[model samples]
Target: MYQNLDLFQTSGAMARHAGSRQAVVAQNIANADTPGFRALQVPSFSEAVKNSGVGAMKMTRSNHLHGDTKAAVVARVIESAAEPAPNGNSVSIEDEMLHSVEVTREHSRALAIYRHGLTVIRATLGR
Candidate 1:
């Protein structure tokens, strides 16, 4: 049974995080000219995972873990630390572009992990 396949779960979470980050980057770019609009950002996937307490422990059964099982890794939008311009807009196109590039790489890495995992599973299955 593949019910507990953590590899796929992790890859999926990474992809989702990258997508969410991309969305935030896009939003920041779109609001670059809006006065008082602060640039938004999502924490890195690793940070989010750590904060979400993922992989901190494993549960063999429903009651095995007494802690919260509802903790899901999610991208929480936060204000960027970039200083605001005279117009009070904090978004910098250059920074947003860089963030977009990082997101692209993260998404690619997630897909690669997922693909390699499938390949390994298929090889194990002799297929």
Candidate 2:
């Protein structure tokens, strides 16, 4: 009966997204000194969800809905829009540090959501 619970799925997705973003930030930092290496970034969680059509109608069969099915919410890495330095490298250690902090917060928020959801479920069951 709980197989369709979206709360857990959402929290998990959020956590996964944060992890992906963190990886990209790490990559950017690692290449900070590489000439011509542009910084990379992933879109925000909200944008990813919106573009993926997470809550949209699904097509069980090709002809079922006559529309596109929901796409997987993937955290795609894109080239950052930051201006490149004289060496042609775009990564800024300060910016990457800030991104790391943001990713940490996002992961923590996801965990809190999942934990609170479990607590609410337990309370509902009088556990």
Candidate 3:
């Protein structure tokens, strides 16, 4: 029933985006010492959610390659801007930690919004 509601979809997308970012940050931190390892990052939650509505392309002709529009909507991994150390490793522990904190906050905020919206709906229905 909630699928019809845009609020639920937005909150869910935000949560997914945050989780993806957190995972990328964690991986970067884990590989900080690996030589030639480059840090990676994903787009912000708002940006991912903003472009989530694009529909999948229709296969009008056999020459057209199939594509999943939904997959494209998710965050894209990009190289981080952190300066590389002498070993050519670009992962910075301090920066990754800060990014992790931001991801946590975004996840929590999205969850809170979802819960509060449900509460308001329940109150309206006197449930």
Candidate 4:
């Protein structure tokens, strides 16, 4: 049980990030018709995964891939709301919805992985 704690913690973090991403996406969609509003986007999430650094799983890549550093992942998602908006509104509902769905799915997947790990641990303990 204690050994599986890390996985749970990591998954919780990822889920929190996904929830944050969803809120940003929702904001973008809500502001789509508002004047002077620019769409907000979530930063690179795969980079976040790499930075989690659980290090239990390794990627099988032929050429070495420059793994993302933890600092890069920790950086806050800054809103670049300076895009030129002809109608004073830069948000796009369709795009925001699509991105939100994708992020939510990823969060669910991560939770599933965490649950599976816990199940395995429980089985090993004969619980």
Top candidate on TM-score is 1
Tens digit per residue, CA lDDT, model 4, 31-63: 887888767766646666575553534334646
lDDT per residue for candidate 3 within 25-53, as digits (tens), equals 98998998999999999978766646664
- Model 1 accuracy (lDDT, Cα): 0.90
Indicate the residue-level lDDT of 1 in model 1.
47
User: What C-alpha root-mean-square deviation, in Å, does candidate 4 show against the real structure?
Assistant: 6.6
Which structure is stronger by TM-score: 1 or 3?
1
Better of 1 and 4 by lDDT: 1
TM-score of each: 0.91, 0.87, 0.81, 0.70
In candidate 4, where is summed lDDT lowest over 10 consecutive residues?
Answer: 67-76
| Candidate 2 lDDT by residue in tens digits, 11-117 | 88999999999999999999999999999999878889998888787786887855556556889889999999999999999999999999999999999999999
Q: What's the number of clashes in each of the models?
A: 0, 0, 0, 1
Q: In model 3, what is the error at residue 117, expressed in angstroms?
A: 1.0
Question: What is candidate 1's lDDT per residue for 1-127, written digit by digit as tens?
Answer: 4425888988998999999999999999999999999999998898899888886665556878565554579899998999999999999999999999999999999999999999999999999
Backbone clashes in model 1, listed as residue pairs: none
Record all residue pairs in model 3 with backbone atoms less than 3 Å apart, i.e. clashing. none
Off by over 4 Å in 1: 1-4, 62-70
- Cα-based lDDT at residue 59, candidate 3: 56
Q: After superposition, how far is residue 83 of candidate 1 from its true place, in Å?
A: 0.2
- Displacement of the residue 94 alpha carbon in candidate 4, Å: 1.3
Candidate with the larger lDDT of 1 and 3 = 1
